[model samples]
Target: MSGGAMLSLDGVHAVYGRKIRALRGVSLEVRAGEVVALIGNNGAGKTTLMKTIAGLLAPEKGRVTFQGRALSGLPPHEVMRMGLSLVPEGRRIFPRLTVMENLEMGAYSRAHGAELAREYEHVFTLFPVLGRRRAQLGGTLSGGEQQMLAMGRALMAAPKLLMLDEPSMGLAPVVVDKIFEIIARINQEGVTVLLVEQNARRALKAAARAYVLETGEIVSAGDSASLLRDPAVQKAYLGL
Candidate 1:
């Protein structure tokens, strides 16, 4: 799992406005078939890094490479077409759309036919609640259901690398546990995951390796178990 690099960011720098920097000389890599967690506080540039990788935002300096191809100025759609799918922080499903419709929208980049149908079935298999609620409006579902929908939507892309931003946000503890379980299951199925989570313990537990970001910088990085046991990480992120 760690032998090949699926994605890499070398000295990446990203900014919100001309003057406000969001990431500064940040660098990391996601190896093939590994779950890599990026954990940080509220304003720690976690979402900004995901957007940069997904091509919603471009780096001011450095490069983003996926599967050996550079993704520096590509549009989001182009990035998606190249096998990177991002489940954004908020469950931004179409409020007016039905569950099935929202899922269909996720397959817009894919060809229509048997392959698409199989992907739909795959999503349904991963999330049976979605299969049961196929006709429900996206906005009507519970927070956990909506989060499942978001993940299902991303899986529709058949991504080689799945980028999840705050998948546990605004959910009950049990729901969060279930979500993390599903995420681990997803990784087991061979989709490399780059997960951005503020829940440090859970994130560390889920990922093989972890990086801690603070004020646009990667302050700590190592194997997840070591980071979890580190005195600094425990005090700062785990409330120990």
Candidate 2:
């Protein structure tokens, strides 16, 4: 495919426990300032794919290139510094740490502490509730708040591409809607996004382009508008 893609994975393969194959020659991409959603049912290797791109998991075969730079062996922290960040499946915040402290952790990789602080202000603007409860421990926040905190933390890293896995997994409809709204706003502000969501209706609506994954491979790919109208997609995801 095109080397100009913001994030690209070519023939990536990964295994778990030296037995189970999680991804098999999977290749995908998310361009700068675009939102690409990866949708699939349970055990479709969606999360595994995101982990590979985020550097949380290494590919046993093939390669990942972010902005044309190879990212085969880089650790997760190193990847974050390269303007890529993942919100992960769960909130994954520190129970003992205050919300502000968690946000600080996102910026630890950046040398400019003061610049990160300014970026923190932008995060607060996006999720004012986080600023309102900055003193509260992350563990004490509600599920929706925790999701917001997770997003805020990723923003603190000042990423060019933000990868979120199952961000709306277990939230209320209202909360899920708000989270998606924030995602759209973030994209409008110029940060590219790669999102994995169980809520296909919400994800496809929010994304510019989308891919349908079955097992470890892509079954269909297209723009969000077309995907929404696809008969197979409607039957499987849209309930139409």
**TM-score of each candidate structure, all chains considered together:** 0.97, 0.96
- Candidate 1, residue 35: CA error in Å? 0.2
The residue-by-residue lDDT of candidate 1 on 1-240, one tens digit each, is 243788999899999767789999999999989999999999999999999999999999989989889999999999999999999999788778999999999988888999999999999988999999999999999999999999999999899999999999989999999999999999999999999999999999999999999999999999999999999999999999
Candidate 2 whole-model C-alpha lDDT, 0 to 1: 0.90
- The whole-model C-alpha lDDT of candidate 1 against the native structure comes to 0.93
Model 1 clashing-pair count: 0
- Candidate lDDT values, in order: 0.93, 0.90
Judge candidate 2 at residue 212 and give its lDDT: 93
Model 1 reaches what TM-score against the true structure? 0.97
- Whose lDDT is greatest here? 1
lDDT of 2 by residue, 19-102 (tens): 879888888888888999999998889988988888888899999999889998899888888999999998798879999999
